[model samples]
Target chain A: MSKNDKKQQVETTGHEWDGIQEFNNPLPRWWVWVFYVTIGWGLWYTVAYPAWPLLTGATEGYKGFSTRGQVAADIAAVEAQNAPNNAALAASDLATLQTANPALYSYAVNAGGAVFRTNCVQCHGNEGMGATGYPTLSDDDWLWGGSVVDIAYTVSNGVRNESSPDARFSQMPAFGDILSNEEIANVVAYVRALSGQEADATAAAAGQQVFLDNCSACHGEDGKGDRMVGAPNLADALWLYGGDAATITQTVKNARFGVMPAWSEAFRDGGLTQAEVNAVAIYVHQLGGGE
Target chain B: MSQGDTPLYAAREPIFPKRVSGRFRNLKWGIMLFTLGIYYLTPWIRWDRGPEMPDQAVLVDLAGRRFFFFWIEIWPHEFYFVAGLLIMAGLGLFLFTSALGRVWCGYACPQTVWTDLFILVERWIEGDRNARLRLHRAKWSLNKLRLRLTKWVVWLLIGLATGGAWVFYFTDAPSLAVALVNGTAHPVAYTTMAILTASTFFFGGIAREQVCIYACPWPRIQAAMMDEDTITIGYRGWRGEPRGKASDPNAGDCIDCMACVNVCPMGIDIRDGQQMECITCGLCIDACDDIMTKMGRERGLVDYLALKDETREREGMKKTPIWRHVLRPRTIFYTALWSAFGLAMVFALFVRADIDITVAPVRNPTFVTMSDGSIRNTYDIRIRNKNGEAHKFVFSQTSTERLWLSVEGSEARVVEVPADQMLQVRVYITADAGSPAATAERTVLRFWVQDLESSERASADSYFTGKVR
Candidate 1:
């Protein structure tokens, strides 16, 4: 009962260092039980989940849980939930989309933005501000058209590609084989003059008659390129290729051939679905370009 | 000592503090009523925040990612205000602890308040100290079982109410109360209530002072905040020494009465001097004062005394004034720091603009050469309207050189932003061909959005990239 007697009764570990002796005290019973419970939980967890790696794959535990499988299931669930909306989007008329069904229009735009970022960003840029060769979708200039229906058709069939039979097709003869170098140079001067760039006036006047003789069929008599033929307007400041004198001369000689692949699943393998095509077309149309 | 017999842990010895009445005890009761009343009643108070917002005076709307306190609404981006408040709370604790010792631990701590309530319930059902002690040691009988079950049920109800009051802070109190009674609340709500109830019951009713001594970090931290001038409860060993019966003329003013020990919540003998286990609740002071009055002797045998004052009093010198103990440099510094944070937060809250704008220029294909020979830069401009009603915002540009500003999807450079919503629009700033801005590699520009209704405006500075001509 005495304090000194109680101190003397306490046990110490058999080892001593200098005058210090380690007390041989037991851990708290609750802590010891919790440690045992954790060990049991670890064994159960290993049995219930994929834990060990085998020769070809990991062990398929009782629960058959895999993070990869879980992620795939989650994606599938979301896709299934959106199936009705996607179906409605594919069937909705693009012209009446904004007025008749605003919710569907908003959904299409958001969905289309996602699709465009994944597939079209490489050439069209993140905000659809096209690169030098690619046509900018955010601008008012359009070679074919800029309407929602027009954009949808262009996106589905593409331009001058062999993948789709209905692809917008246009061909300009390589005038290099017919016209002399002097004649090609004069026509380049006339084309530059049409776009309001500095050019040789005499050579441009001479080339105006030559333009009427050959290029007028596709480029129109006024040098305003026809959209039906998918010809770019020479008078516009936008150019698919460079509008400098040298670049103009090269274009008049060899002509330009831009090929866009079809995006519809019916036209190519691993292509976009009808809903995805509509979505992307709506997304591109809303980028300030659609007329 | 033998190697196998040493004990590392010991079971807790339960404390049964007998009730006492005095000035400090009355103050503690008043504080308990005020704090508990605020906690249980705050969520039920309503304020008019218009029809579009929740009316709760205080709400943590996790679903909306906002904290609504009276007229102030905090967005996630304004989390620094909450952080400032928390820092102020910490400094306030430091100030009080350095000035008056563990006053927070003794009177205002949630653990102390709830434990006091639980002990009151126990005393009501099982009788006070001696009766409760007898009940604890007696063999299990029908009468004991009835009393124990009654006490436990009341404690459980108090715990339930504590947990129930907590959830009302997150949602509308009346609706959540209805849903709770109808068994229609969210499963998470039920789960949170259950968890809080269990913790309250265990910590307040069962663990009591053990939570302060073993679990809480505040008691350990308070040691660093206290110095010689800090006022704390202590036994006047100089006055009450040579303890004996009242009739003993040789004894000092001290009759060896155990009243102080009997009323201590931590069950420590105050006559043994200051120890870390003492929360300084002053219940012992109350008990000793009552005993001293009965014996017709002077009181303050156990009282709040500073370490320096103890030494001065022992040497027969006058103790310093109470204000001298409180107005020291450390407490003043903590008070100043706490006030600075509060004032800064208030200034920021009042000066914050209702409209916020951010401009992020498209980096890939930084500048586009338009068909008209003009240079164009695309920006993803986000405008946040914090107003209660929609307003049309006129988008304009200011630059050193001439530039044309246009908003996508609108003919005029105007956008109608919905109230309390953020709208992202594609903005185009174009420089005419051969213009100074077009020829420059980069042109500095400020994009401004002015509310058409109120003329309130906000601007963000961004640079437009041009083709290096």
Candidate 2:
């Protein structure tokens, strides 16, 4: 509107569209210079880096930078950071490390947790709480010893832990071989009473002598059996073969010893170290009920 | 007249783009060769990813829910990487559009390149533009019959190759190739090939320029992005109008050659001014330049220029060339946006992780109480192993009373996860019956997993329900 404003160099083309006019203004000064700079830079970049596709390959740029090299450097940095912890795990005894160093024990536990999910979680639960037949580690009761060392040994050798005749050797013999049918019936009644199952008083009393003579050798007179022999304590009320009349009768007659595969073979085959297993034991103990 | 004033009822004419040759044509051919070569060959390339990972160089294993690209293995949880890649591609398009108009559509678009290739085969068998036009006009001949049959055969072959190469990206390429050759590929593979073949033939061989003009949204969007300064393939009307025969005393520089129209792939006369169908491939410029040399006139009768310059020159005003208009505000804004997005994507990749966890609250009876006076909640936790090696995860929780985690079946707190597998199990968390809120209160708990050797820990949060005391 002003004379000075009208003197401004910019001009709009005379031709007009609906309501719009084309400003015949020159591009911004900064924009033009930057465009030139980038064009120059692009030329340099093409020379210095891989830009053009060749018949057989690509032209190697002068700078020699590569995504592969960058990735390799990152992996190396991570590896360097992990070196010390890896060494510590390789050197220490699992049980001692767990009891002596909480940090190291925790690391092992964490490691073992990962290992468990990978190898053992399919059969065992994710947290090592056993399914129907699988034993739960979060309880005070343990079939094998609950001590870290005891657990390590059990994991290393396994239950029925032997490779031969004496492997962790423990079994309850069949009372049916020596006792009469009536006597076996009475013993079954007495065993039920030990587990607080109902039994006729007369039947249990009649079986007492037969139990004392035949069963009391491994099972104490009180029916608190030796754990060393794996003869479970009857009074404690945890039944391995089950406290039912039929199962008890069958167990007493045939005797029962379940095979627990040796953990050493599994350990070696699974590619787990002894210390790693110890860490898992300590982690299992921390699950709440270890003595 | 302004574009809006043009008659709306004007019938649209079908275009059969005639083929051309020269710099841009050769450039398009080179791009097609390289892109199709990579597409067909990449799946067969091998990578040494040790023993646990897939060896295909580029593969999307859907059943495994993983993607393998050379040394990089992507787990399903890390799908953000793929999203980031798509963002980068979009940004790349913006950058290219700001700098060079429709370069992507002209040289790199899959549709344009393939259609051009198919058209080349058609021309090779049926002859050039004029000959084909003349043949269509003439009565049926044995020569014409043979040419048409040959063209169809070639078009089908190209379609089959394009479709056959696509399935290789989804599975082990070499093994799948053997299966295909032996007639034992999966039925799904056969179905995919059939579908792709039909689409390629219909789109690239038949539809051609109709896709660029009507079927695509890009041309409309690109029109919005352009400003007065934007360079499009244009005709210099000042040098072309006041039309007369070439030999007339008043004849303008154009010389009525029509060479530009003959060479256009979209078959539009650049001299008629910019149209929606121009791909900006610059073939018309090459053709018109060649014509100008013969007529002994100044070149660029049809050229790349802005609407403002074209109008001003026609009105006899001195024109400011391309360099003067290169630094506009729109160009600067687009450049800055593209750079910022690219940098953000790089930063995100650095912080992104390869590990993830999801917790599911038990559906049936969410909370349970034990005989020993403890309140318990059950959850089915699914832990995914994203790395290449198997790992163990230890579970722990924090609550009012010391919260104990028991895996329903296993005896160990350590859950071992196989590489690239999801481990699911029911976990029971119990707090002593003496807790402050014994009946029902939400308690926030944390589950942490530490890699035994690396001591790296990952944690997730979930709530446990208990009876209020």
Candidate 3:
């Protein structure tokens, strides 16, 4: 058949655009059936799933499915699977946990890493590499101690905090009130010399007598620091609050007081569980600084 | 012409194609066997890849994130190889379509092959075209029900086998087959097989020509790929027109026997000139040639002919040679593009390293100050061992002589990576306080890992941050 003959047989929609008329060719029956099937499926889907929004909340359909509920269930399931391990880790002795049960120790370290990410990253950083004021957990320059037991105690009671009675407590009397500005400057030079930084030799010699009288009790006579009092070692170059002349002068005048929160739930509300405290201790200990 | 007469939808017209035998039909049969054989049997072929890797020569180990084909293994990071192959397949289709017309659609398409097999089964059970048509039009009866049930069961079985073969490509064939019989295979495997089976049966047995004409996009795209020199199956309207009986005085070669239409799987008339519905299967040419020979007429009443050749023949001029038509610039360009991708992929596969390393510097606290006033930067280095046996790799730095490398848990800068697995280790690079690298804001660090046994080294460059003061 010719094109004209076929065109004449088919009806036109009577809508013309730029002199081209639209043909009213029927769609395939299968396509129309599929369209109807989709409509039916959509109607069923609304009834079976949470679809409509109301004033209070979305309408809970027959399935009662919510993404929040799904995530909660997933977390609960994982927690249930690790319940035994968590219980064992919480009860194990921090000193001998690693050698007694290496598998459980390993599990605690991984689990503690997750807890540390959520609760400790703000101060300790993501990799436990601390900032200027904060002490790096991955290094051997811990002000308190690097042993797993010491870490656990610090994490449980915290440092110089009013919340826990057993918190690691230390107080440095601010010397700005008692000592003159010249004395503070001379002591700063002496402190810098102890850490092997450039210092005024005459001032450092004079400040040595002042340091023995004022700072030797907590910082030790040799300036090696005392772990019992959580005093930082002045013999090493690792500084928590900078080793510069200006910063050292400020520290000698007013002293530094860093407060950490007690992580054990026994001491504070919303604190980490016993198992979490144990895990984080193991994780921090394994960061290459554990004794 | 009336609005009321024009319905909004039209039903599909069922086609019962008559069976025909010729060189083209035989060629289709041979291609079907060859392609199907390769599909169903490839997964079962075994190659000894040692104890650490899979033995299947052709397998898509989705769980392991690897693609194994014979001697070559592809990791997930090398998915560009798969992309290159798909590009080559597309170019090959273009090359064939430009030279010959819908050759893939006619002879080698999975749809065509499966549908042909389904038709062969239908012919064997229903006694060919006329009998099948009569049976289709006849009212429901016990005999009709029996024949219909038998044909559906056979079609379903063929579909099952096709689906079964497909799943074997993803896993170990023998174990999966045993698990399937034991009803213990993964639910996903069962679900995938069921979906593929249903689709194969529906498209091959029932949908048939509708899939190529309405569902597939290739036929529409082929229109742009073909030009006047493209040889396509066509009826010689110049010679075959004015069709009449042999007894007529002024009759043409065609006897109006409708033999070509009867043999068409697409249910299209080749005598209507070129149409989109025709697959150019050459079956019509085969059928018409048989009829022309019996009538003592010259052959090629329906044959593969280019539009340009038709114009030449009508003008009483010599036709262009087949080589000239196939070797034109368009076909040559497509062939060259297709070959280039194939060669590039092969070269990449051969030159790929057995050990791969990637270093990601920890940037949270850019640099850490150690007790000794040294600046340390941490990196998470992932080493992928593609070898069949475990190998120890010694880590070292090629740049920044002041930088010292240390592994996290080891006393020495050495790590053991398991065979065919990727292991991540924490690496610390330290620069002494007096060194220039320790004071620079950023230093380019090139870390190298060498296999202790083979000494094959792979290096990755990363930035090392240090204290600015």
Candidate 4:
């Protein structure tokens, strides 16, 4: 290598590594030209995009584009793509939601779940498991019916509320106005006995006749509450008001009719859209209770 | 003088590759036919995978996150199989390079085959090497213009076909082909085709040998992969050193004929020591052998030989079989690595699950205290059904005997997924009141989704969080 270099007399950087001299070389013209093109591209990129920091904000490039705007556009595109499915979900019945198209059903359920977390969970308890006076929606029983349309109607109109004029209406007629306090207590015992709860057998035996004569008109002869009048079944362990003797006595004295606010656009407080209403209704129905 | 005293870039000298017929040429023709045939026809072959799945025998379904190759189907979660195949490919390249240097670049590389075809078209239109040289040197004329235009158009059509065959691997070939013809395909498809066509035309036609010489990094790096035992085209310098014209009595076997130089695609003289630009194509050896046969001398004036063999010949040793040079430790190591990757990938492909499930707990308000004093948590369960048929899966949770699994609006606690699709369902698992697991602050809940019609099952575990109070 030294013999050849002596003959060629090529200039070097005068640096040697392991007897090999370093020849100072210039960048290839093609490489230099490409490097210039890249620098030009970089300048153009900064001018055409949001760049350069300022005291207030970055300089808005000529395009005036921001990642925020891009994200918003992306979101809008997704929503637009799903608009028809959303519309179908809004109009679909529960069977169609559950069976015909699981994708749409899944959309409604997820949307409904979100709605539940925001609004309905406050009254219906977490996971729609109602507390005390509020109904346990996760049960297999319902005051009216657990069907999807029934749940939709109930969610939209509410129960005996001022928001919807078509709200579920029923009155126990305040039987205490006619019967004595002792009579109310005896009827409570019989109602508890029908649901297989511990009760005074003697008082229950006497209350059975009283129940047949007066209460059976709406409560039925067997003490199973009627659905037409929006009455609850006394034969079930589930109690809308309560199963306790004291609570039943109080309910008989002045009827228990809990009110749920209307959640439809036809009601107050900037009610939900039809889609949102359907979502919450679907959510509640899926809470292990819909028949 | 400064290093910049001389120009940094040298202009490309034209290479007029004269046509030669030999065993190597026939082998190159056979290889090009096989590889190009596979590239263009693989997408059109149909493999029935039932109704809801794509039938393309070899497809990379990017949107669907699937790769289908005949009897094998790969999902995104099983991407290690693809990785394994790529590893195998890398090892295979190493194995072949150790045995025969730059064999891939010579006959099988897309660059070599496509450039050869484009050159063939040019020669057919403009005549052979001398005719082309003459035509290029001549002033522009109607005849020259017509031939140039005709050759370039053919080249462009070949480029278009090359690009057209590539897009079919990503979608249903017949439908995509129709859509491409009608301009109804996705804009990206057209953009990809245009870019590919442009690159093929520019690289295979205009760039030609310049790409192998200046642009490609392989020729620069491939020297590192070779050892002295690796077979390459070599000129028998010992026998051919004393050279002259055919009429000179002092001349050795090799006359001063430049047939080897003219026939070289790279336009480099093989008589010089090996250089980085050599692709080991053996065409120069073929050219010299024909000349040697005509001169009534030995046919191996330039031939495929290893450096070790050359050394042995210098030491007056007898020739050894080719296998003695090929079956060395480096080739054996590469072959072993290639086999390991291939075997591992095949095993993984067979054992991979067609159905997979993943459950993630909703962390915002992670646990909900039910009215009955039990704690409940919801999960987003994503089910990927890779099978060709739809399936109904029963989802059940474990970690507590009293825990109940209920799907959204589904009283049956089962989920249904379409063939080759993913379905995400919101699931609620509620612990029973007064249960030990419900009262615990945290517990791992395992949710198993089982196929109703098959024995396939996949399970995912998530933490079921609750407050101790």
Q: Identify the candidate with maximal lDDT.
A: 3
Best by TM-score: 1
Off by over 4 Å in 3: A1-71, A84-110, A147-149, A161-186, A245-257, A286-291, B1-5, B316-321
Candidate 1 per-residue lDDT over residues B214-306, each given as its tens digit: 999999999999999999998888889889898998897668778898788888998898899998899999999999999999999999999
DockQ of each: 0.35, 0.02, 0.36, 0.08
Error of 2 at B73 (Å): 3.9
The docking quality of candidate 4, as DockQ, is 0.08
- Stretches of candidate 1 off by over 4 Å are A1-68, A93-106, B1-6
State candidate 1's DockQ: 0.35
What order do candidates take by lDDT, descending? 3, 1, 4, 2
Q: List, residue by residue over A1-291, the lDDT tens digit for candidate 4.
A: 456755457678889889887877778999999999999999998888999989998888999899999999998998788778768877777655767886677688788888788878887877676778888776666787778788888888888888789987777788879888878788889998998789999999888887887689888888777877777788775777778898988888887768788888889777776777787777787765567
lDDT of each: 0.89, 0.73, 0.90, 0.82
Alpha carbon lDDT of residue B82, candidate 3? 95
Q: Note the residue pairs that clash in candidate 1.
A: A11-B2, A237-B371, A238-B371
Task: Provide the fnat value for model 3, as a fraction from 0 to 1.
Answer: 0.69
Q: lDDT tens digits, residues A1-291, model 3?
A: 566877878899999999899999889999999999999999998988899889998878899888989999999999999999999998999888867897798799899999999999899887788877888998778888898989999999999998899999898888999888888888888988998889999999999999998999999998989999999899898888888998877888888999999999998999989999999999998776778
How far residue B227's Cα lies from its native spot in candidate 4, in Å, is 0.7
Query: Tens digits of per-residue lDDT for model 2 on A1-291?
Result: 555465354587765799676668788999999999999999999989888899998888888867887799898996577557657875776546745775676677676676566656654465554454455454555665667667656655656645523345677777677888999999889988876778978889888888898888887899877657756667643455566888888888988776655544353465556555655666665554454
Which of the predicted structures, 1 or 4, would earn the higher TM-score when compared with the native? 1
Best by DockQ: 3
Over B80-117, each residue of candidate 2 has an lDDT whose tens digit, in order, gives 77887787777677656665667788778899878878
Runs in model 2 deviating more than 4 A are A1-291, B1-19, B244-246, B315-326, B398-400, B433-440
